[model samples]
Target: MGAFLLAWDPGGALAARIGVVNVQQVLTQSVAGKEATQNLEKEKVRLQGLLRGKKEELDKFAKEAQNLQLEIEQKGAIWREEERTRKTTDLRRRQRDLAREQDEMKRLLEESQRDLTERQRQAVTQIVKELRDIVHQLGRDDKFDLILDSTASGVLFATPSSNITEKVLQLYDRKKKK
Candidate 1:
């Protein structure tokens, strides 16, 4: 009963209405090449370095706090309880200051990363629109029934004859050159 309900309803009819392209390959090789890849990598490295430096500062603060804790433990017994309490309060204040700085740094880093991602997404979206236009023109020229992006769909095994990625890239490159 389950198999009967799940049987193919459209069969060969749906196959006639679809075509596919590897947009990932098209964008990598055609739209943004080695230069764009390198620039993005350099930007990533710079951002990482900034974050690392901030983390190092935080680590240093943690180390100072740890040292103060040790000092308090050693001096805690020798001093009057009120004197020990005052030193502990001072140490706690320092820790709170460091924690606030670390939190602000983390928030800024997250916001910067989000901004970079949004900008990259916008640039990719614009490039994809241009590629789509090129592909649509080619589809019209070839009278294709439909066009699909194999990369977006996670299609691993498309026949070379059926794939139009290279052709679209060629047209897109030519258009760019002109």
Candidate 2:
């Protein structure tokens, strides 16, 4: 409607019927989108729980190492030279082990997060593709000159009469039902 005009044709020779679609609305309201979102949320929560458990384990290990270091510091003066050296070496080894464990856990968590993000991205992309196809078909059937995503900046304002989002949603939901 007023989003854009047939400015090039002042004589009213070219009357283009443009349609708008609120893609974000379709994504949130559609059954497939809801299912995809729910699934992703579940996976996200599971990953968070796993990460929390691993962090707790690392925290416990770090606390144990700290306690051992404190013990050595308080008792080192009366200890034999060999015992002190052995304890110092043990502390150094434990420190290295802790560092390595933290790095490994960090890497694993990053990999898992990356994988989950990628999966969510791919799912959304597929859903968008489906919506695009439906929009295209709607355009063809209704003889619309152009179909714009109202969610995009290209469509600043569109008349309600021109928005096909509800129609598109109905069609999309029906398609997913099969």
Candidate 3:
């Protein structure tokens, strides 16, 4: 009760061939991966420097402010009554400025993280699409029913002959050259 077409279906052989192509290597070694890693490293270094500078500035300010407070405390109750209002105002101002600086740094860091994630996602999606297209072509050429990604599939082991890591890398390199 099954209908058969006149053309032959080489699904098994084609799927095996595509599997051997190993598109994961192609994506991992591609330019996108290199660029994403490079940019992320650069951002990481820049952020570290920014954090160090901010922390040092805050520490210096805190030390100087503490010394000023101690000087006022030691000077005695007579001068304290005279300058209490001005001292409180100055302390509140310093606290507010420090808080603002901390908040700004945190916001910038969060923005950088978001940007990095978006860039990585974009690069990955582009590479995956390219690999899928190549795999689809191979499948068409060989008449495969399905070409499964071993990484996303329930595959435990594949024989050396079944691995297409090198082939996909070569193809990727060729495409990059073009």
Candidate 4:
């Protein structure tokens, strides 16, 4: 029992050096992250513009249809039955065309949204990959035995001295600049 107690290093003299990193901080502060955000915002703006234009077009079509209906109602009483029927048929055909156009526009908007989401996901993935590489390099260069993500690890408390998040961000930005 005495020998076992002597051999045990309770002071952790041989324990691995631990490092803590705030991954969210690094992700939000890194240059690559900023660029990714800007790109996503630009895509969102462009998509919004397209959707707005389509909506305007739909509104115009609706107004035109309304105007045509009003005209038919005003003149139908004086016209022959054949003419009135022909005009009603034209209005129904135009309504169907308008519905088709509206459906197409909705489809286009959904597709654009999907495409934008995919692109944003890819960009975030790429940033995460780069961040991993940077963290790995930092650990190797600094001789860290273990680096843990504070956020993911549910670390409620850690001394500021043990945190390496800022260093990782600096290294990442420096490498990106090159």
Give the number of the best model, judged by lDDT.
2
> Model 1, 140-173: lDDT tens per residue?
8888877889978877777777798888888877
Prediction 4 TM-score vs. true: 0.87
- The list of candidate 3 runs beyond 4 A from truth reads 1-24, 76-80
Candidate 2 lDDT, 1-178, residue by residue in tens:
5535535667778788999999999999999989999999999999889889989999998998999899998999999999999999999998999999999899989998898989888988999999989998999999999999888856878899999999999999999999
RMSD of 3: 4.5
Give the clash total for candidate 2: 0
Clash number for candidate 3: 1
Alpha-carbon error at 1 in model 1, in Å?
23
Ranking 3 against 4 by lDDT, winner: 4
Using TM-score, give the best candidate's number. Answer: 2
Which lDDT values do the candidates have, in the order given?
A: 0.80, 0.91, 0.68, 0.89
Error of 4 at 10 (Å): 2.0
Minimal lDDT window, size 10, model 2: 1-10
Q: Give the clashing pairs for model 2.
A: none
Q: What RMSD, rounded to one decimal, does every model reach?
A: 5.8, 3.2, 4.5, 3.7
Provide the global lDDT of candidate 1 against the true structure. Answer: 0.80
lDDT per residue as tens, model 4, 41-91: 998999899899999999999888888899899998999999999999989
